[model samples]
Target: MTLFELTNSLKRTITESSYGQSEKHKLLQSEYVSHRELVQFYQACNPTPTLLSLIRQTKLHLPKYKTYKQTKTKEFLKMMEKLRLEAQEAEYRKLINPDPEHTTLYDTSNQEYVSPVQAHKELKNQLTTIVNVFISVGSVSYAVWYWTASSWGLRDSYRVLLTVFFGLLVLVAEVVVYMGYLNKIEEARAKESKKKEVKKVIKTYDLTLDNLTAEKL
Candidate 1:
């Protein structure tokens, strides 16, 4: 049978078989599943034929759209953790009593609140776009390469070697670009964080100075 026919038959057979939702499926969706499975069947290379079979069976159930729920959860956790730490810091600041102890002066200026989490969130949005694009393009390319390589003798030892090398090169380039984007995002977040810190310090300094001046009167 032609590869297309073979693939279709396999897909149809698996879809007709019994499959049900399970915790494992949720985990797979959250971490392991990728578009390459749709294009190249690389997921079948897994040592667990049973799991591979399930993957094929559940292909029809895979969502057409990408969801970054896991990433959002991670960001939310980070934000909450930061907020907790900031609260503790605020408590410590109050304890230290920056205003002169000799005077009954109190500086009640509100602290400037800046959230670096928003920057992280925006970065995640951009990264999600990049990831979707990469997966879509990579899957399509792999499908085309796999289909034509052998037919054109490109899958022969010498040619296959070159094919593999070129594929690896593309993979490396994609990884580098992905990492570069992440680093740029991190730098942007760092800059925003620095600004927040500077502003926070300035506010504290101004309040302290104002309080001290009032005490001399």
Candidate 2:
């Protein structure tokens, strides 16, 4: 075909395409100085239309289209949440593939489970118990000192019993604080697991949307 025929055919396709008015405005605004590059891009699908169009045609909708303020706010917040989730997924991918020096081992030929942290924790608990016994003994010694020096004799059995009870209370308080620390650790693990599940759910939704979009096109 002649050059003029080819150019006319390209213009025809561009003018007949499904680009929106705002999109056409942008394309026409940032067009090449020569006017030929602009025609080429519009005809060849060189650059995609704006993300707004794609989103509108998908399961998502725009806020302006909704009349109620509450609906608009909800839609805007949902959009932001989706964007934030996708961003976190991208960040997770970057973290998983940080550097070539720290490649992940995928081979499962020789697998052996190890729990060094759990083993260390068990040992630490045993040591903590030993320390608690020592603390209890020390408290008993203090109680005995006070009882002997402050005019309390073995004849007053109730006073000696009360002192022993207070010493046991101190040991119980220490154990309660130790148990709180373990509870905090468990809460942190649960939070991390929840985040992982949320990420997985978002990724699955994105994949389903992508497949639907492909089918539609």
Q: Please give the TM-score that candidate 2 achieves against the real structure.
A: 0.32
Clashing pairs in 2: none
Assess each prediction's global lDDT (C-alpha) against the native.
0.55, 0.57
In model 2, which runs have C-alpha deviations exceeding 4 angstroms? 1-114, 144-148, 151-156, 197-217
Query: lDDT of model 1 at residue 70?
Result: 50
TM-score of each: 0.29, 0.32
Q: Where does the lowest 10-residue lDDT sum fall in candidate 2?
A: 53-62
Among the numbered candidates, top lDDT falls to 2
- Could you give candidate 2's per-residue lDDT for residues 16-79 as a string of tens digits? 6676666555444532213353445445553337533322222221234656555468888999
Q: Residues 90-203, candidate 1, lDDT per residue (tens digit)? A: 878766645333333554333323358967886888788678766755675566567667566454565555555666676777778768987997788667656632223444
Model 1 residue runs over 4 Å out of place are 1-155, 196-217
